[model samples]
Target chain A: MSAVAQAPGPARFCLVLLRRQLTLAVRRPIEIGNPLLFFAMVVALFPLGLGPAPDQLAGFAPGILWIIALLSNLLTSDTVFRSDFEDGSLEQLLLAPQPLFLSVLAYIGAHWLLTGLLLALVSPVFALMLNLSAPAVGVLVASLLLGTAVLSLVGGIGAALTVGLKRGGMLISLLILPFYMPVLIFGSAAVRNAVLGIPATPYLAIIAAMLCLAIALAPLAIAAGLRISVDA
Target chain B: MWSFFHKLGSPPWLYRIAGTILRWLLPVTIVALCVGVTWGLLYTAPDFRQGNSYRIIYIHVPAAAVALAGYYVMAIAGAVSLIWKMKMADVAMKSCAPIGAALTFIALVTGSIWGKPTWGTWWVWDARITSMLILLFLYLGVVALYEAYDNKEAAGKACAVLTLVGMVNIPIIYKSVDWWYSLHQPASIKMTGDTTIDPSMLYPLLLMIASFYALFTCCLLMNMRAEILEREARTGWVKKLALGYRS
Candidate 1:
C-alpha cells in the first residue's frame, strides 16, 4: 500500500515505461522482423528494377539503402503510440505525475531501440548485398544510427498527432515526411561521401546536430499532440 | 492594447474588421499588381545576357519571397494560438496555409517557366528549388491535417504543433541558394551591400514585392473572414448578419 502511494520520479517512470515498451515489442517478435524483411525485399527489387549490373547497384547503393531505412522508420512510427492509445494506457500516462515530455521521450526511445537500432545494426549486410563499398558500410551504419534517432523522434510527432484519427497511416506520412528531409539529405550525403573517399565527418556532424535539435524540441510537440489527441 | 487583443478574440469583431481592411487594401493591391506587372513587363529594359526571358523574375522572385515569409506568419500565428488559446490566431493560421501553398505553387511554376528559357530545362533538383517544393508540402500538410480531424478545435491545435515542427525548414529554404552551389542565382537586393540589379528593374521589383505582401495580407484576411463565418455559423451575430443581408 505504501509502495503504491509513493510515485516514481520522472526518470524512474521513463525507465519503467521504456522497459515495458521493449518487453511488449519483444513478445511480438513479428513486429521486430517486419521492417528488416521489408528492407531486404526492397534491396532485392532495386537490383532487379535497375538491372543486374553490379556497378550500377554499387553506385546507387548508398542512396538506395538510406531511402529504404527512412521508409521503414516512417512505417513503424505510426504504431508507436497506437497500441498504447488503443488500450487507454496513453491516457493514464498523460494523467501521471511525471512530465509528459520525458514520458514522450521514453516512448520515442523505445521506438528507436526496436526499429532504428536494429535497422542500423543490420544495414551493413544489406549494404554488402547491394555492393556498396566496404569503407562506406561503416559510414552507412553510423549515419543510420544517428539519423534514424532523429527520424524516430520526428516520426513520434506525426504518430502522436494522428493517433486519434481513423485513417492515420497515409496521413502520417504527409504530416511528417517534410520534417524527414534534412535527415535524409545529410544521412545519404555522409554515406555518399564515404563512397567517394571524402571525409564524411562533416555530414555526420550535421546529422548529429539535427539529432540534438530534434531531441530538445520534438518531445514538446509530441506531448502537445498527445494531449490534443486524447482530449479530442 | 489588452482590449484590442480581447477584441481580436471576438469572431464578429474580427470578421467586420477584416472586411473593412480588405475593402481598401484589396483594391490597392490589385492596382499595385497591375502597375508592377506592366512596369516589369513593358517598361523595364531587356537583360543583355538573357534578353526578355529574364522578366519572369518580377513574378518568380516576389512569390518565392512572400511564400517564405508567409510560413513565418503562419507559424507565429500558430504560436500565438497555442500560447494564448486565441481563436482568431487559429483562424489566421488556418487561413495562411492555402494562401502560402498557392504562392509556393506560383513560385515553383514561374521558376520552371524561367528555367525552360534560362537553364534550358523544365526542372532540376537544385537546392533552392527542392527546398521550395518542400515548403509547399509543409503548407499542404497543415491543410490536410486540419481536414482530417473530426474536431475543429483539436485540428487547429494539431496543425499548430505541426507548423511549429515544420518551422525549422524555413531557415534552410532561405539559405539554400547560398549554402549550395547551384544554378539558381543569389539575392540581388542586399540589405547592407550594393544592390546588383539596375535601379529601373529594382524599383518595379520592389513595388511588386510590396504588392505581393499586400496581396498576401488581403488574401489572409479574406480567408479568415470566410473561416470566421463558417466557424461562427451557430452564433447570434452571424444569424443577425445573415438576416440583415437578406432584408
Candidate 2:
C-alpha cells in the first residue's frame, strides 16, 4: 500500500518490517532479554513453590506455563509502543511515505520478532525445568508462537488506545485479560492434552483458528485506536 | 417529530420528562413488579420436577432478559456516538455500562442459586451461564477502559470502539447455549406456548419482564439527565434551569 512503487508485494512489507524489528533487537539485546528472563523466572518459580517432585510439577505444568506466558506477554505490552510514542518516532513512523497502518503493523511485527519467536525458542529450556513432557513442550512452544503473536496484535491495540495515559499498564491488563481467556483456555488445554498423550491436534487447530482471527481483526482495531488517540 | 427529537436531546427537556414520568412510573413499576412477582410465585403451580425451587425463574429470567437487552441499548448508543457524533449518545452509552453490569451480575448470581436447587452443584460451565458471565466481563471491560484514560472524550471514543468490538460476545453468549446444546443442557423454561409450562407461572414472569423494562427506562433516563446536566451546567439554558430550582 505504500506509494514508493519499489515493489507492491506482501513479502517485501513483511520481511522489511520483520527485519527492522529484529535488527533493532540485535542492537539492544537487553530489550529482548528482559522479558524472556522474566518469563523463565516466572516458570521456574512455580516448581519451587510446588516442591521438587517431578510428578507434582508436571501435573501443574500447563497452568504454570500459560500464566507465565500471560504475565510476560503483558509485561512486554507496556514497552511495545511507548518509546516511539514519547520520542516522536511514532509520528515519523506514521508519516512515513508508506501507509500508516503498515508502519503500525511493522512496529508490532517487529515486536513479535523479539517476543513471540524468541519466547517460543526459549520455552523448551524452562519447559524442562517445569518437568513438562516432550509432547506438552511442543504444544507449549507452538501455542506461544501463535498465541503471543495474537497477544502482540491485541496488546498493540491496548497500547495505542492507552498510550497517552499515565500508568496504563494495570488498565491494559484489566482490559485485555478477559479477552485473553480463550487463549489461556485453549493454550493450557492443548498442553494438558499433549501431556495426556491425547491427539491434541484439535486443540492446536482451534488455537490456529483463533490466531488467524486475531491476525485478521486486531490490526484494524489497533489502527482505529490509534486514530482515536490522534483525535484527542 | 424533529422538534420532539431535538427537545429530547436537551437536558432541561429530558429532566422535565423524566421527572414527570418518575412521579407516576416509579409507583407503577413497583406495583407491577409486586403483582408480577406475587402472582408468579403464589398463583402458579410448582414444577413437577424442579418444584418450588423452579420459582427462581421469576428473578433469573427477567434479569437475564434485561441484561441481554441492556447490552443492545449500550451498543446502539455507542454506534450512534461513533457515527452521529452526538454527546448525548456518549452519555447514554456510558450510563448503560454500569446498569447493564449490575443486571448481568444479578443474572449470574441467580443462575448459580438456581443451579444449587436443580443441578446439585453451585456451578457448571453451561452455555447460557457462561455467555452471561462473558457479557458481564465485557460490560466491566468497557467501563474500566473508559475510566482509564486521562482525556475524557478520548476515553469515550476508546470505550465506544471497545464496545463495538466486544459486541461479538453478545451473540456468542446467546447462541453458545444453543450451539453447544448437546454439551450444554437445554433451557428448562421455554417462553413459547408449549406443553410443559403452566399458564399461572407465565403471566407473572411476563409482568416482571415488563417491570424490568420500565425500571431500565427509568434508570436510563435518570442517568442520561444527570450526564446532560453535568456537561451542560456551564451553558446559559442550564444556568437558567439550575437557578430556577425552587427548593
Candidate 3:
C-alpha cells in the first residue's frame, strides 16, 4: 500500500512531536498518576479478596500483577485522543508543519512515558507488599517496563483508530486485546516461570521482540488511522 | 487516476457488482458446506483413540482455520479500503468482521466442548485456546470500533488500522500450539508431515476445510452486499439498481 510511500521525513517529524508530547506529559503529573493508582489499587485488591498467605500470595503475584498492568494500560488507552480530539487541539497539531506520523508517534511515546514507565516504577512497593521475591519483583518490573511500552504503542493504535468514535473504550479493548495476547502470555509467563525458579529468558525475549515489532509497525498504522478518522 | 477514484467512490456500481457475486456464492456455499459436513460427520469414522469426539474436528478445525484466514482477509481489506479509498473494500471489511467473530466464537465453543470429553476439563490455558480467545477479542474490537462512530469513513479507518496492527499476532496464534503447554493436538492439515491419524479422518477434515472456505466466501459476499447496500442506498446508482435498470 502507498500508505508508507507518502511518508515525509519520518525521523525528524517523530522527534519534533516526540519532544512536544514528552513536554506535555511532564506538565501533567496527575495524568500519569491515574494508571499508577489503578495498578496499585488492583494489586492491593488481591490480598483483601484472598487473605494473604505468603506462599499463596506469591504464587498468584505474577498473574495479578500482569492483569493489573493490562487493565491500567487499557484504562489509559482511551485517552489517546479524547482530550486533544475534543478540544480541537489535535486539529491544531495536525495543522502544524510537523509530519503526521511523527505527531502520531509523539502521542504514543508520551502515552508510554505517562502510563508505561510510571506503572513500572510504581510496581516495587506493590511487589513488596504482595510478598513477591526480589527476583520476582525484578522480573515483574522489567517486563512491565518493556511490555507496557509495547502496550502503549499498540494500545495507542486502538485509541487513535477509535479517536473519532463515541463509544471508543470498548472498541479499543476489542482491537487491542488480540495484539496483546502474546505479550500477556509471554510476559506474565516469564514472571510466573521466574517465581517457579525456571529460566524466563525465552519469554522475556518474546516480549522484547513483540515490543520491537509493535514499535516498528503500530506508529504507521496509528498515523494512517488518525488521518482517516480525522478526515471523516 | 481520476477515473479509478471516481469508480471506487461510486457506491451504486459496487453494490451492483457485489449483488452479482452474492447470488452465485450463496448456492455454492450451501451445497459445499452440506456435502463437506455430511462427509465429515457421517462418512468419517471415529478416531481409534479420540473416538466419536474426533467428529468435532468437522466443525472445530474448519472454524479455527477459517477464523485465522478470515482475519487476514478482513484486516487486509480494511487496510486497502483505508489506504486506497475504496468504498467497496471498506464494506467488505466491515461485513466480514462479525462473521469472523462468530467463526472465532464457534472455534472456542467447539474447542471447549471437544476438550471436555477429550481432556476431562472445561478449559485450559494452553497456547492455542488462549490465542483463539484473543482472536475472538480482535474480531470483537473491529466490529465494535466499526459500529462506534456515526461516521462510516471514520469507523472504517479505525477498524482498518486496528486490523493491520493486529495482524502481527496471527503468526503467534498459528504457532501457539507448538509453543505452549496445551493439550490440543498438532495440525491435521500440515503440508509435509507423516500422517498422524489414518487417511479416513484426514480426508473428511480436508473436505470440511474446503467446504468451510466455500461457505466463508458465500457469507462474506452476502455481508459485503448488505453493507454496500446500506451505505450506498442514498446514491443515484443505488436508486437505479433498486429500480432494476441496466443502463
Best by lDDT: 1
Cα lDDT for residue A49, candidate 2: 82
lDDT digits (tens) for residues B86-204 of candidate 1: 99999999999999999999999998998887778899666667788989999999999999999999999999999988787557434533343331235432121353789989999
Candidate 3 lDDT over B40-158, as tens digits, reads 78887777767888788789989999999999998789778866778778887888888898999999999899888777887876566777887887788777777778888777767
> Against the hidden reference, what TM-scores do the models get?
0.95, 0.85, 0.87
Give the clashing residue pairs of candidate 2, or none: none
- Name the top TM-score candidate: 1
Off by over 4 Å in 2: A1-20, A92-97, B1-27, B115-131, B169-197, B245-247
Candidate 2 structure quality by residue, lDDT tens digits, B114-224:
888777889878767777887888889888888877677787888887777677435533543344443224566332325566677777888899899898878887887
Candidate 3 wrongly placed segments (more than 4 Å)? A1-28, B1-14, B173-195, B244-247
TM-score of model 1's chain A, to 2 decimals?
A: 0.97
- The two-chain DockQ for each candidate, comma-separated, is 0.62, 0.38, 0.58
Candidate 3 lDDT over residue span A1-232, tens digit each:
6845655566766776677767776788788777888888888799889897888988888878888899899988989788888878877767766566667777788788888888888888888788888887888888999999888887887777778777777777767776766677677788887777888887888889878887787878777767766777
Query: On lDDT, who's better, 1 or 3?
Result: 1
Sorted by lDDT (best first), the order is: 1, 3, 2
Decreasing DockQ order of the candidates: 1, 3, 2
Clash list (residue pairs), candidate 3: A174-B141
Report the poorest 10 consecutive residues by lDDT, candidate 1 chain A: A180-189
Better of 1 and 3 by DockQ: 1
